[model samples]
Target: MTLDCFCGGVRVTTVKKPEFLHACNCDLCRKSGARWGYFDPSEAAIDGQTSSYRRHDKPEPAVDVHFCPKCGSTTHFRLTERAASTFGDTMMGVNMALSDQADLVGVELRYPDGMAWSGEGAFGYTRESRILGPDG
Candidate 1:
């Protein structure tokens, strides 16, 4: 799959289908207006010089959000060494806003409560979402 930011400054390519598609209600995610798709670093590739925002809320396992330089659209994310160790070394998060909505028509979405994510707790999933298009 190939996707790009609004102004086309950032581009992403996924070699394999996403293992998980999430619609997180985290502060940052809510503001950015993007759904997420989880994949291995080797499975997806991002091409661009994007600006990144590192969440300072958590000390370890940094989750860096990367946005397009031109349109400032959140495109993807990169996990730091600590995060890689905490999760998987190769895990990456892709923002679905990079792709056309039609392309995501049939994909299922998982709702996660990232706003309350804690070190001692696991993410609380709220619900499942499905794309409802003309076909439906």
Candidate 2:
């Protein structure tokens, strides 16, 4: 599967289906203004100019996040422990906002309630779709 950014500045091709898909309520995650989906890193075939940023509270040893250098659009992320696990090492968290084909992904949106979320996550879609239909 190929995930392309809405601006066409970033693209990620992966061979494995995402292990799980959910939205986060972390401050930075919300501020980034993206809907979230995660995948196994081994399944990802990444190419393009990207830079990684890390969080101070990452549970894993290292959480490398990839983003488009040009537009500063976050694309994906990888965790250190997940990278060494036999169960398809490496985990990638994708920014749903970057995807142009979000609806086709069949992503089951989630709203993490533990932390403070800026705007509604997948809930926004439900409201929007109700008002504008799937075309929205």
Candidate 3:
């Protein structure tokens, strides 16, 4: 699948299927405005100019989040090692927010543990799960 930023500056084309899909509650994630679809290292082909941000001092080498260089829209993310594993491959993470037909993706939202923020009142686990599906 191919994911493009709202403004179409950054685009990620991956052949690997996402290992898991979830909605993160970390403050950074919330700020970036992304719903994550975590893929295995081997299943992704990421391109475009993605800037990095290391907030909250994550011990895991910096999560390289990519954004649209032209419009400043957050696009995608990958672990340093995971990005390296692709070595020019293709992967997919359809950003629901920007997707014209996001509902077709059938992605269920999941709560990833260890986030810096919480969705206490924003949403509930069961509600999100039902929307995202069992794989989320």
List TM-score per model, in order.
Answer: 0.85, 0.65, 0.63
Q: Regarding lDDT, does 2 or 3 come out ahead?
A: 2
The digit string of per-residue lDDT tens for model 3 on 47-121 reads 667665545555543356667767888776655664456444343343435444443256555765536333233
Between candidates 1 and 2, the TM-score winner: 1
Query: Cα RMSD (Å) per model?
Result: 2.3, 6.1, 6.7
Residue lDDT tens for model 2, 1-136:
7777656677887664443445555666676766656666566666777888776664543457678888778788776555456335545677756545544354445556525433334333212111112442
Show where candidate 1 strays beyond 4 Å. 131-136
* Candidate 3 weakest ten by summed lDDT: 119-128
Q: What number of clashing residue pairs does each candidate have, in the order they appear?
A: 0, 3, 13
Candidate 1 worst ten-residue window by lDDT: 127-136
User: Per-residue lDDT of 50-93 in model 1, one digit per residue for the tens?
Assistant: 99888776666467889987889999888876777776677778
Q: Can you tell me which runs of candidate 3 are displaced by over 4 Å? A: 16-20, 59-62, 81-96, 116-128, 132-136
Taken over the whole model, the C-alpha lDDT of each candidate is: 0.79, 0.60, 0.56
